[model samples]
Target: MKNILTLSLVTLSLTACVNRDNQYDYIETPQPNQVADLQDDDTDGVINARDLCVATPDESEINNEGCGIIITSSNERHLHILFSNDSADIQPIFSSQIRQMVEFLELYPETSIEIQGYASKVGNEEYNLALSKRRAEAVDRRIESMGIAADRVTVVGYGETHLEYDGDDEMSHARNRKVTASVVGYQGDIKKEWTIFSRLPK
Candidate 1:
């Protein structure tokens, strides 16, 4: 009877101690400010709260922040062809430019360009529009002769609508007669350009 009484008391004391410690040491779990399952709008595999770049490009390898780590760059694809007044003939001085067009077309077979032709602001708008168009076609013909398909190069005459030099003076007018273009292509979803450089004989 005496041993039974002592065991009961000891058990009660242990239970009391445990309850007291639990009351002091126990902590509640913290709740988040946002919902746990927000949408990944960019499909970058990261949720909005954790993603620093929310609109990451598709298929770009992303970090925890959902931004691309693949470093990329862009090169200028500007094309310019200067012309003598009233002449649609491409000068011999632009041989380098012609090669540039040919090589670029060969490399990216699917790419195409629209040659925008411009004339000096001093000429008649109607007449200049026609002249500019001829200039654009002249470039197309040159490129077409070099072996790029006719379908790959399109031409448009903007005339003096968008001028490099917006003045009616002689020098400024001379500066405005030109054909220009830019070329671009996509291997996957990435836009790409190439610059073919040649070393001139010193």
Candidate 2:
């Protein structure tokens, strides 16, 4: 009877040990869901562990990993300033247009501009090219004087290559000899004004 009791006790002890070991093995094993949590389902250059914005669109500009599209706002203005025949000087009647440009530049500090000068078909090719260049430079200087950075402005001479009016009339020539200021490359929201000729009397 004593031997039988001892045998029964030993059997019980071994069974309990086996059950405890099995419990520990179950706890240490990783599940399928846990493994998937560490994987990146969307390949947006961001891992699943730290990605705030999952499933981002491909080829979109993002400022940070997993972040949404980065947008840049800009306003483009084409301002025409007509010049007198054979001269690069800005007319005094266009002072209001210059003031408007100054106001715009002040409102949008990140804006940059390109001043393109054009001349009528009244002079030789070389003379027209130089005159156009001088007109553009004159406008560039005027803008610079209004506290805009010099580096932000680009001056170009289109000469008679891009004439607004091709006819041999006084009004056509007046329209051809002009400078065009284009504001571009700005970031964020912008308030654009009407073009110079848009407000002028016909």
Best candidate according to TM-score: 2
What are the RMSDs of all candidates, in order? 12.1, 12.7
What are the lDDT figures for the candidates, one per model? 0.80, 0.79
Please give, for residues 84-198, the per-residue lDDT of candidate 1 as tens digits.
Answer: 9888899999868977978877877778888899998775899999999999998888888889999888899998888878766888888899998998754433322222553
How do the residues 68-184 of candidate 2 rate in per-residue lDDT, one tens digit apiece? 554566665567899999999999998788778877888788777888999999979889999999999998889889898998889999899998888999999999999988675
lDDT of 2 at 157: 98
Among the numbered candidates, top lDDT falls to 1
Name the weakest run of 10 consecutive residues (lDDT summed) in model 2.
188-197
Model 1 has an lDDT value of 0.80
TM-score of each: 0.55, 0.56
Residue 42 of model 1 has an lDDT of: 85
**TM-score computed on alpha carbons, candidate 1:** 0.55
lDDT of 1 at 49: 72
